[model samples]
Target: MKLISLLFIILLRFDGTTASLVKESSDKNTVYVCGSGKGKRYHLNENCRGLKSCSAKTIKTTREQAQKEGKTLCGWED
Candidate 1:
């Protein structure tokens, strides 16, 4: 039916817009890291399991700086 098709298109468009909004809201530029492993693991949240066992200090830094130092997303957080 034409109505069904139109509804589908509208739903699809709305879903896409909602997804973009969620992504924008969750945009985490700041990362938490422990001073170890050559800066290889960075977490978007401080409570990530990857940092739970960390004995060193958990410092906050930007994602760009973490990447520049060869850090990757923490397995537990991302």
Candidate 2:
């Protein structure tokens, strides 16, 4: 089972699909985002510069929840 998982990961990397894998894995990780209607980004760190401009309340949630709300990764996250 472990070998299969490893092979799947390797194949995902070879095909440049690691982003999906990473996202899938990080779905459960805590992320921060603005709670306003205009909010459209998720930050791995609560103090990310991207959240500085947010006038609404900052909320912490799972990355998956943020994505479900149409939020993308904050530009500053890179």
Candidate 3:
């Protein structure tokens, strides 16, 4: 029973740590920018330049949405 409990705790900790790492990596990869005459936008992996800066938000969305919203903004192709 003790070994089982210990294993469970270790597994839980591992899972939580991995989850946080993934989230951090995702945020690091995401970027946002604004155009000279455009509005704010987000990009996954692109060099963006504009008046506005970029950041990561708690709200989650799909890549399609990011591309759609950031169309006016700038981004790196690969």
Candidate 4:
């Protein structure tokens, strides 16, 4: 019984931590990218000047996903 209670407390703490992390990640996860372009940078703003030369569609994606696809932050990004 004591072990079960301890496990429950641990699970609650983990869940709270995970929730906070997810919230923080979500706040900054969304970023803009160019689809099918020679450029390999992600922009924080859709209207960034760097995006002006994009030869493809502007896409919204997670920052992590963009990095996974070999993209880095745009030089024009703040």
Candidate 5:
């Protein structure tokens, strides 16, 4: 009983750690967008379907700057 509980706790801890790591990794690979509507950051190659339309000039900007532009821009991989 004690050993089973210990194992369960360990498993739960490991699961939490894995979840956090996954989130962090995903965030690291993402680009942030600011301006227009609520303004939010998105991952590379993710669709920007509903956001405000952006121009080619905005698309050419660095990921961080693009985020500040607040317009729909294609992800780097796109």
Candidate 6:
């Protein structure tokens, strides 16, 4: 039917869009955070000076997720 063909076209478009999004996200570099802080800070470099004295575990996360969680760039890296 025409409706079925239209639905298939829409599904293909959605799949292509999803694939592009995944590729873009994966192309970005990963960020890190020192869990010792208030979780409001993120660093592009794991060895940033600001993280030198981290007393807790370090976590790896994406920049977008960090921003959503209200994390700011570390002064040492900014």
Report per-prediction Cα RMSD to one decimal.
Answer: 7.6, 9.0, 9.1, 10.0, 10.5, 10.9
The lDDT values for all models are 0.78, 0.82, 0.48, 0.80, 0.47, 0.76
Q: Per-residue lDDT tens digits of candidate 6, residues 16-70?
A: 8755545444656678887765767888766678877788999878889888888
lDDT of 5 by residue, 10-78 (tens): 676579875554554456435534333344433343234523354322122256665565544444434
Q: Model 1 over residues 1-78: C-alpha lDDT tens digits?
A: 999988866676579875554454477787888976555799887768888888888997889999988889988766
lDDT of 6 at 24: 49
lDDT of 2 by residue, 19-58 (tens): 5656555665888898786888898877789999999999
Better of 3 and 6 by lDDT: 6
**Candidates ranked by TM-score:** 2, 4, 1, 6, 3, 5
1-78 in candidate 3: lDDT tens per residue? 999988866676579875564555567545444333244445443333432253432233445655666453343333
lDDT of 1 at 65: 91
TM-score of every prediction relative to native: 0.60, 0.61, 0.29, 0.61, 0.21, 0.57
Clashing pairs in 2: none
Model 5 accuracy (lDDT, Cα): 0.47
The model with the greatest lDDT is: 2
Instruction: Supply the global lDDT for candidate 1.
Output: 0.78
lDDT of 5 at 36: 35
| Clash tally for model 3 | 1
Instruction: Summing lDDT over every window of 10 consecutive residues in candidate 4, give the lowest-scoring window.
Output: 17-26
Better of 4 and 6 by TM-score: 4
Winner by TM-score: 2
Task: Please estimate how well model 2 matches the true structure, expressed as its whole-model Cα lDDT.
Answer: 0.82
- True-vs-predicted CA distance for residue 41, candidate 4, Å: 0.3
At residue 43, what lDDT does model 3 achieve?
Answer: 44
lDDT against true structure, model 6: 0.76
Which TM-score value belongs to model 3? 0.29
Candidate 4 stretches with Cα past 4 Å from truth are 1-26
Regions of candidate 6 where Cα sits further than 4 Å from its true position: 1-28
lDDT of 3: 0.48
